[model samples]
Target: MEGYKKIIKKLLFFNEPKKMERFVLKETSSKENRTEDSAENNAEKDKQYRARRRKEPGGIRKIDRGTDESSKKEKEIQKEDENKRKDSEVSVYLSHNLTSMKRLYNIPMNGDVVIREFDIILKDRAVGAFIIFFDGMTDRKVINNNILQPLMMLSSLEIKKAEEDIAEYIKKQILPHNQMKEFTSYRKIMDEVNFGGCAIFVDGIAKAFTGDVKGWEHRGVERPNTELVIRGPQEGFTETIRTNTALIRKRLKDEDLICQNFEIGERSNTPCSMMYIKDIANESLVEEVAKRLKSLKVDYLSDSGELEQFIEDSSFLPAPQIIATERPDRVATALTEGRVAVIMHGSPFVLIMPITAEDMVKSPEDNYVRFPYGNLFRLIRYFGIALSLLLPGLYIAITNYHQEMIPTDLLFSIEAAREMVPFPSVIEILIMEIAFELIREAGIRIPGPIGPTLGIIGALILGQAAVAANIVSPVLIIIVAVTGIGSFAAPNFSLAFSFRILRFAFIIIGAMAGFLGITTGLFIYGMWLVSAKSFGVPFLVPFGPKTANAFTDSILRAPIWKQERRPDYLNPKDDRRQAPISRGWMDNGSKGEDEDEQ
Candidate 1:
């Protein structure tokens, strides 16, 4: 071993022969020391690592506790904020102090809020009274002539005798306004003030009087932008809910026509009017609509569109269950047919409920036009609906899977047009369809008189450019144009939108399995429609459940005299719309002659 050590030392250190023995001895000692030191260092490191691992869980626990505390503090702050808001909404009570009433209005801070203070003389006593209104919301002329003029100047002479109750005397004989109400809640009074009305507060009275002086600038009852008919009522619903309800009421003039008022939205407090002929409409249907509207807990309801989305039966379905129309005549007609109309404040569109697929397709003109012409137009619309939904999918299916379905010359032509195109038929169609949709959306959003013109020009230019560039085949352009025209032919805009969405879906399905995929998709769509319900009425009504006297009105428009009964599907209280012998004057005098002969 010593000899081997000497050889290693000579090779590694290259020491002199005399010191080789000493070097070997020193190297052996150093190796033993290194082994001992390495063992000790490793043991120390293991001990330190174990100590850190043991403390890690505790540190994590402390962090979690800190997070929990922070979350708790945040929740507490939110709770306090909510409580403060509720406290601020405390009810208003009439105090003998006029300064307190002014404070209640948050005067000096709110610039638009106006408070006019005056004295009312009753014999020898003068009582302090004030009126509060928003600047732009209320009509200053009406408030001056009707409310303030009588209370401030005319009341002194009118109440020559001593008045024990000032509130009753002013309310009964002083205020000449037609629409005035006494309200006790501060929340309610503020709401009235916000919505174009003035509130009168008396120093000695516990209640405040609210008058309807809503004369803010608004659009007049104009012709409907959508749902235009050739021979029907020209007037449409305005943004004002009262005016809309009045429009419907004017048409019906029935005592049983009920228009119940509801306030929806937490912040908005938008007025919603539910109208129905009490004797004709089903009770359950009306109650269902009310229940849905009441149960909504939203902070703001901007329009009928939002309300419809929230209360609709199914959000996943593409088809709109509620029929939204701006026409007051349509609302009246639906009310007569045992349907409920929900008119939202600040939106011209009125929602007609318990609608069927057939109802969406029918235009108001169908009723006004002669039966033969109406039936012809209705049939054409049906064809348009089919073309819009199925045409593109059929094109994709036939070109991809069943080319034999097309005529020989047409197939050759399609092949020639597509030869220059780089993409497949499916891709080409998708490109064109997407381009068309973009054009449609741009047309709607573009401002001014150029909007409609831009849409037409844009579509024409895009179609021509696409074909010229060979990005899309010429045949596809014609197919897309026809599909777009068909979409326009749909009577209801919502229904048209539904068809547009389904067109894309069918296109995708057709590309996958051709004819088989289209068939499957159609079956599923039909099943969904049949299963869906709009306010308890089946979406595919008069067809799925098969109601009598309803089928004639669905696809075909029967003569007005023959359609003597209301739709059986609605379960209207009154089934007969007219007498069986409605056209008795035109009939032969068989019964009258027999009676005369006897």
Candidate 2:
């Protein structure tokens, strides 16, 4: 141990500047050319070496030779200087080489390492070589048969193949049974390998050869259960972007459909893609969405939901400012409307930005049906929204304060129903509303057959039991149930939740001051709705503030022939969507019959 300590001390002495300078100048310079300090130090060291050599003649004596020679030996001194300079250069090279070698070879005892016993001898000269093994990363047979078996059969000489040759060899022979792509840089290769790729590092080369090993695991395309339609394509967006795009492209066979990609996050390297029609879509909207998505500086991203929050106009907004949809038709519709769709690599849902309140209320199914029925359905949705948001609040306001709006007979009936109830009308309504929301949430969270059963049983058993127990009035329970059903009638889940939250506030306001309070609450809520912006577009556009396209498909759907243009809110440069001549088909048919009779 003592001798080993001495050896380590002597090795580390090379790191000291003064000693290093003395050592280098003596070895790398002639006696005449040597620095004064080097000459003096070499002379002292030589004297000590001579004394030691005299005392112990058999032992090796270390001496500095450059300083002891005469002036007539100037030529020799010059030769020695050149030779020493070369030696010094070699020594410096060796020092750096050894330092790097030590760093790479000195594996920490506490860190991760695997000791693999191989029959073939490893080259003793190389110091930085290491073996990396990943548990469960492959079929052991694939590793042994495809990789290790070939490697074990090769001589020590075969370990040093050039990167390109190794890549070509793997492609031709070793990985012949499987498809693989080769990459040059180790960093790129390592990334691929970590994500189920295979990498081979040659003995001498800095670059590593990598093979693509992307696992065959992806869900098949299925009809979007969430965004169901009666008269459109049954297929929907899948986790695979390729599958999702196919669903869209099946509907639109245009070559102009553009899909542009951006790599986000330094570590996560999350791939985000923007899709739009090159001709029909607005370039600025595409650019804006792309710019915002690219500017995100998150550490990691796993879903479109995370990306949506980052890129939305205001992250703190209670209502979802950007609409997320699973339906390809919905996305295609948004693209036609000049809105941008952001799709992430692994996410099934694509986010549509700058969507208005009317946009949330309307469904893709509306466009597929006849205009009259579509108009009727859309009106029902509008009524659903009004009933969902205002019914409970209105009930509380009318019953508590504005009895004039209620008929004497109805008021008498309500009074009789509330006679047994202990809580006020507002309290009873809130309790039932909250209970319905709980049941709805629980229904969604529980799995399969149990979910629907739990919801039905929970609502029925709980609501009925509460009413019969005089915990809530029958009339209030009816109002809460109607409100819950109305909220469900909304097309978007996020919009429904927003309506639910807003209804609670209306209930509070109605309870506080009756009709005046309800009126004030509606007024304030209207302002908030009007003031809200979905990526700078008025939330209540085409309805609350009203635009010319307001009549096109706002509260009611117009006949396809009547809507000659897309929504004006989209800022579509080519506004016209269909031909004007198509509007007179039925009329022209009737006129043609009369002319034929004449």
**Top model number, lDDT:** 1
Error of 2 at 244 (Å): 2.1
How far does residue 404 in candidate 1 sit from its true spot (Å)?
1.1
Determine the backbone clash count of candidate 1. 0
Roughly what TM-score does model 1 have, to 2 decimal places?
0.84
* Regions of candidate 1 where Cα sits further than 4 Å from its true position: 1-105, 157-164, 587-598
TM-score of each: 0.84, 0.69
Best by TM-score: 1
- Poorest stretch of ten by lDDT in candidate 2: 85-94
What's the residue-level lDDT of 98 in candidate 1?
42
Write the residue-wise lDDT of candidate 2 on 1-598 in tens digits. Answer: 9999999999888754565434453354455665566778767765654554322121312334344433233445445543333232111222332232233324343143222333323343322322233434444556566655654554243436544544355346544336455444334543554444455444433444444434336788788877788898786677766667777777667787788877777667776778887877666777788788878887788888888878877665456788888898888877766677788878999898888877788888998999888888888888988899989988988888889999999999989988999988877888888888889889999988999999988988998899789898778878888888888789888888788888998899888897788789778767877888776678888776677765777777677778777777667666777777675777799899999999
Candidate 2 ranges beyond 4 A from true positions: 1-187, 190-213, 543-546, 582-598
**Total clashing pairs for each candidate:** 0, 0
Report the lDDT tens digits of candidate 1 across residue range 304-348: 999999999999989999999999888899999999999998999
